[model samples]
Target chain A: MLEVKNLHVTVDGQPILKGLDLSVGAGEVHAIMGPNGSGKSTLAYVLAGREGYEVTEGSILYQGRDLLDLSPEERARDGIFLAFQYPVEIPGVGTNSFLKTAVNAVRKHRGERELDAMEFMKLMREKRDLLGVNEEMLRRSLNVGFSGGEKKRTEILQMALLDPKLAVLDETDSGLDIDALKIVAEGVNALRSPDRAMVLITHYQRLLNYIVPDKVHVLAAGCIAKSGGKELAHQLEKEGYGDLAGKTGAAA
Target chain B: MASETTTGLPYADRFAAIAATLPGQSVPWLRELREDSFARFAQLGLPTPRVEQWKYTNLHPLTKAGFEPAVVNGQGRGQIKALQPLSSLLPAEEPAHRLVFVNGLFRRDLSEIGALPEGVRLDGLGEALASEAESLAPMLGRAVRSGDNALLALNTALMADGCILRIGRGVSIDAPIHLVFVGAAEETALAFHPRNLIVAERDSRAVIFESHVASNGGVYWSNPVTEVTVEDGAEIQHYKFQDESLDAFHIALTEVEIGERGRYHSFVMTSGGRLSRQEIRAVLDGKGAECRLTGGYLARGKQHVDNTTEIVHAKPHTTSKEVYKGVLDEQGRAVFQGKIIVEKDAQKSDGHQLNRTLLLSDRAEIDTKPELEIYADDVKCSHGATAGELEESALFYLRARGIDETAARRMLIEAFLGDLGEDLASATVKAALQRRVSNWLAAI
Candidate 1:
């Protein structure tokens, strides 16, 4: 569903991602594990078309089309979703109202009928129950004064609502407890289908234990140094990234 | 009377020609008040940029325009009807008693005053002066003085017709009283002065909604003065909406006096007119009084809007709060000047003021000043002002969710102004104001 050829990226004139390449087929889930400064989050941001991230070289193709050419909003309308590491707090903008606007906008772009208030509420309630999110959190302003677990759960709720073709989870397990991690993992597992793909970016092997990936890739110094099965995660956890970096000639 | 060099005012000759035809000319007290106000206006003249109070706002446009007194009668009814939609900001659920005025003259035919309860009187100022002059003798020109502000002095001198509302002691009004002023100047550059008096007696409660709108094709000036007195244990809520013609000018002054244990709440919304200024001065006369003043303004396309307010705490155990916000775009300029004073012996007085502005364009400008003068050691007072562009991260967060750039911007701006709207007590009024804000956003 997605292909990256020698992806090289820079931010503020400093190189972050250098000659990174990866490929994922339909219905496949890939977990990219790396140490600090290994360009995992940079890859997610580049895929979502964030500004100030210069593409020094390389290209990204999604569903046989050049994805980097589209604007961030257009990419969103075309079914690309990025779960932020840190959610933004927009004061005074109700989360319910914002969700309705976003859902309607994407539905309109996809040539589908927009849902009314009642229909949208029904769908939202169903998802909230499935994810164990409270009703009051959905009624308040968008992530304003929210706890770390609540923020991460809200991002997962948005991913469930948008129903994107390709979902990029960026460090979704950084600040979550065991209960929150299970809820988020259950929500993601429910959305898995034959036509959907996901890329999980993480620093630890703990998250992969809940929702196992089809393939695991070790990212070192902006490149995929090793590719293996789910056991590769346990291998890295047992023998840390220090031995791997030396064997793979990784800068880190 | 027309000393051009010494007076420095260009409109003195025009004022002289219109003085003879002003309302209540037969009343000696009214005539003397006008004379005294004229002398004060002549001596003070128009405020210049050099003046400390009027530093950010310039009066050159008003000085250059040759504005004559608007014709009191024979204004086309069709023109007045055309401008009614602009003045209708009240929601349908809340029934209101409306008093319509055209060119500063009362229009009984267009006004819809439902059955008012006993001990309540609402009518035209001219009619009240002619019929019940004795009762109104002590109330007129009592709260507002004629020395410091030149525009207030001008409004007092040429005051023609406005609304007069009086509630008896302990009476409570369920419906809101609306005063809609429409200006239709089609022939010449015209100016009109409107003076409104609202008095809530001891333990009385009421709400007043005031709107100022103008017809499409006109260059006119609407100068209004309003005086409100809240007696002991009384409560009053005042909301003013200003949406004049694109080529017109508006200047208004509102003076309020709150007695012991009284409560006063006011909100102003400004979105139209080429140049506009609304000044409010409030005084807490007795102990344990509370007051809240809040407003929001949206300016664009070279428009200018200014809000100046002052609150005086005269007695102990008084509290006052003020919040004003603005959004400017396309070279639009906005000014906010707020001052709070805690007098001597006014112990335990608490006061707070905040002003915030959002600049949408590169050339837009905002000038804000929040001042506090405390003469008592036992009082708590604070003030703050802020101006900046919208947060880029917030914008991106919304845009990344499939919303376009323009829609994202509108959401952020609405959120910024919605914070102030949430403080309103009436749901109907809040919905109406939200609709108006949406309309303003759509227009831009």
Candidate 2:
């Protein structure tokens, strides 16, 4: 469903993702693990088409076409989602109103009819219980004064709403409690299907116990240093990245 | 003070006689107030180009136009309905009290009232001064230099017809009192001053909504002053809406005094008039009083609106907050100048002010100044003013979400203004403000 060939990216003229390659087929869950500065977020931002993060070279092909050529909205319409690590606080904008606009935008881009308020409410109720997000949290201004856990849960709720083919969970589990973490994981696990793909980016191994990935790729200095099965996550959690320091400069 | 001259214009004598009556009032204190005001008016000379507040809004056109009062014609049912925006929002069918002043004259034919509390007095200012004059005696014609606002002096000098409403001690009025000022056709250049005095006595509570409506292209000048006194433990909510024609000019002054444990809330939504100025002075005379001034303004065309507010913490433990937001379009200009003063003895004073302006067009302009004068040693005061277009990040976010750029911008603007209205204690009033906001946003 997603393909990246020798992708080189830079922010503020400093190279972050250099010659990174990755491919995720339908229904595949891929985990991208990296050290503190291994450009994990840089890759996610590049895929979601955020401005100011320029792709210096190479291209990102999604379902066979150049994904980089499309605008962020167009990319979402074509089924791409990025759950931000820090959900933005937009005062005065209602959370439900924003989600409806986003959902309809994506749907409209695909030649789909818009949902009325009634239909949208139906969509919200279904996602609310599954994501464990309640009405009180949704009634407030979009993410304004929301706790970190609530923000993450709300992001999962949006991910559920968009139901994009490729979902990028960027440090979404960083600040969640264990229960919230489980709920977030279950929300992801329940959405897992052969037709959808997810790239779970995380800093700790605690989250891996909930949503087990099929593969783990250790990224160091912008390029993948080590690639292995699910057990590689356990090895990293046990031994740390000391052993990978030698392979940091190894050939791709 | 050089008396207003009929020297150049034929009907100038009427101006002198009307201006002289203020100096002849019984109270020596009132005479002093009028004389000082006349000096200020003469020196100021109807706001020349030098004055910052009147720079964009020129009053010369109003001064040069020959103005003569038209007779108080009978109220037109169809006409009032067309101009009234408060019809549905008001309890018109429930027989609530309403004081209607059409063309600056108190109209009893169009007004209704119910039994009031023992000490409550809702009557025309003249009648209130004639019979139950004691209630309004203390507040009838006092305009302070607290804010250095010259318009208040003009209103005090040229005060014509309005009402004095006093909700007596410990009285709580559930029904809102509507003070509607309608400006009918003015064959000649017309100048009308409507005065409203509300004294919410100790432990009393009430809501007073004063709306100014006007039509006709004939040059019209409305100088209105509203004095609200909230005694100890009283709560007063005042709403002032200005929706005059583009050719008309409006100068409004609101002076409020809050006693200990009083809560005074005032919101002024100015969306009309070619040239409109709203000057508010809130004096916290007692300790532990709270005052909030929240407002939103939408100016299009060559319209110019100025909202100037000064809140004084004269005693300790006083709190004041001011939030003024403006959306400017076309070549319209909006200005908000708010100052909070915490006196030397006013310790533990909390003061917060925010003035935000959104310029929808490159040609539009906004001048926002949030000032603070603090003499108290221990106090918390913050003032912020921001001037910019819509956020590109937010706009892009909404656009990326499929919300059209125009709809996204409108939504953001509505949210920006709605925050102020939503802070009202009464949801009904908030809803009314919201409706007006949406209408204005949609029109712009």
Candidate 3:
């Protein structure tokens, strides 16, 4: 469902992602494990089409479409959702209203009918119930003064509402306690289906323990140094990137 | 359009033409007031960018056109018009007592004054100037000075007919008194000034709803000055809605005086007019009096709107709070100036002010100033101002779900203006303001 070919991205004229390549098919959950400054978040931003991130080389094809050529909104409507590591606090905009608008924007792009207020509320209630997010969060201005756990849950609620084709969870485990980590994992697990895919980016193996990954790719420097099964995550969590530094030595 | 001038123009002399049409009332106080106000008007002259209050908002586009006073080619008053909001959001039908004005003339036909309780007098300014000089002449110009602003000076210099509502002591006006001001369009560029005085007597309760709407006001100028007095223990709610024509210019000055234990609430909404300035000066004259002020502006196109307020706390235990938010789209410009003062001996006085702006386009602009002065040691006062574009992350969050950018933006703006709406004393007025905001946001 998602493909990145020689993706070289720069932010503020500084090289962040250098010729990075990765691929994930439908129903497959691939975890990109990297240490601090390994371009994990950069890869996620480049894939989701954030502004100011210059993709100088190669292509990102999502479901066989040129992702780089699409606008941020267009990429979103095309079923690319990014669960931000730090979800933005949008004052005055209600959480429910934001979700409904996004849902309809994507729905209209996909030739679907827009949901009215009542219909949208019902859909939102279902997601809130599934994700265990409180209704108070939905009523308040979008994420204004929202707690870390509430913000994370709000992000997951949006993901559940949007149901994008290629979901990129950018370190959803950060800032979340053990309980929040489990809830986020549960939300990700519920989204697993045959026709959809997700890319989980994390620094530790703790989130992997909850949402098992089908494949694990070790991102070193700016490129993927190795790709293996979920066992690679456990190994890295045990020995850290120190083991990769020695193994990929001279050749890297 | 006439050439723009800094000093004086032909329109300044047109005041005599308007004065000639008003009822002949040359009482000593009236003559003194007219002469003094005329002198003041001539002294300050037409407002220019040199004045601090009129700094960001220029009156050249308005004064450049030598329009006859709206009083000259005036159309008689007709039926009152509904607001721009959904009808369900407003109170059904006009209230019990209403005073109507057309081209600055009092229209008793469309007005309803019988709904007021006994001992209440809701009369026209012209009639009051002629008959009740004993009751109000002493306090008419005591509230505001036109010298501070040229348009206000213009209003005083050209004052013709308006409204003067008085509630008797210990009386409570259940139905709010509505004052409607509508300007008529004519061949020549016209100017208009409608002055009003609202007095809620001691221990009485009254509400004022001042609605200003003009259809093709002929690219003319509308200058209005309204003074409100809340006697000891009275409660007052004042609402001002301006939906003037795009070519018209609107300058409104409102001064409010609160007595001991009295409460005053004022909300201003600016949704129309080519260039509009709303000046609010609220004075807490007695101890334990409270004033709550809130307003919002929804501007689009190239319209320029300004909301300026000056609050004074002259007594102990007086509390004042002001909140204003606005959404500017296209090339619209919004300005906010707030000045708060706590006088000596006004111990335990508390005051706060906040002004925020949301710019929807790169071309849109906002200038905000929040000033505070405290001479009392026990006073607590503060003010805040902020202006910026819409939050991009919020937009992306909404669009990613399916809401089009337009709808998302509308929702955000509505949310931004929510708290201010909820502060309205009347539910209908709040909903009406919300509807206007929603319509403007939808169009934007």
Instruction: Please tell me which predicted candidate would have the highest lDDT against the true structure.
Output: 1
TM-scores for the candidates: 0.94, 0.79, 0.92
Best by TM-score: 1
lDDT of 1 by residue, B11-82 (tens): 576565667667666788877778888887777777888888889998778766667666433232224653
> Ranking by TM-score, best first?
1, 3, 2
True contacts kept of each: 0.67, 0.42, 0.60
Give me the runs in candidate 3 sitting further than 4 Å from their true place: A116-122, A243-252, B1-7, B14-18, B72-96, B145-153
Chain A TM-score, each candidate: 0.97, 0.97, 0.96
TM-score of chain B of 3: 0.92
lDDT of each residue in B1-444, candidate 3, tens digit only? 122233355565555555655543456666666656666667676777788877888877764676665554334332235323322223546454766777778877766676567878888887777666767765677677444565666566667778887788999888877777776666666666888888888999877787777644457677888888888999889887888877878888898899899899998888988889998998999999999888889788999999999999999999999999988888999999999999997999999999999898899999998888899999889889999887887766665555567777777777788888777878768777877787776676
Q: Rank the candidates by lDDT, best first.
A: 1, 3, 2
Q: What DockQ, on C-alphas, does every prediction get? A: 0.73, 0.33, 0.53
Model 2 over residues A1-252: C-alpha lDDT tens digits? 899988899999999988888988999999998778889988887887778889988878899999988877677778888888877777999998888888888788778898999999999999999988999888889889999989999988988888889999999899889988999999999989999999999877788999999989888878877889999999999988766855775643
How well is each residue in B318-410 modelled by candidate 2, as lDDT tens digits? 999888888999999998888899999999999999999989999999877777899999999999999899776676556545465677788
Model 1: CA > 4 A from native: A242-252, B1-9, B71-84, B91-94, B130-134
Global CA lDDT of candidate 3, please? 0.80
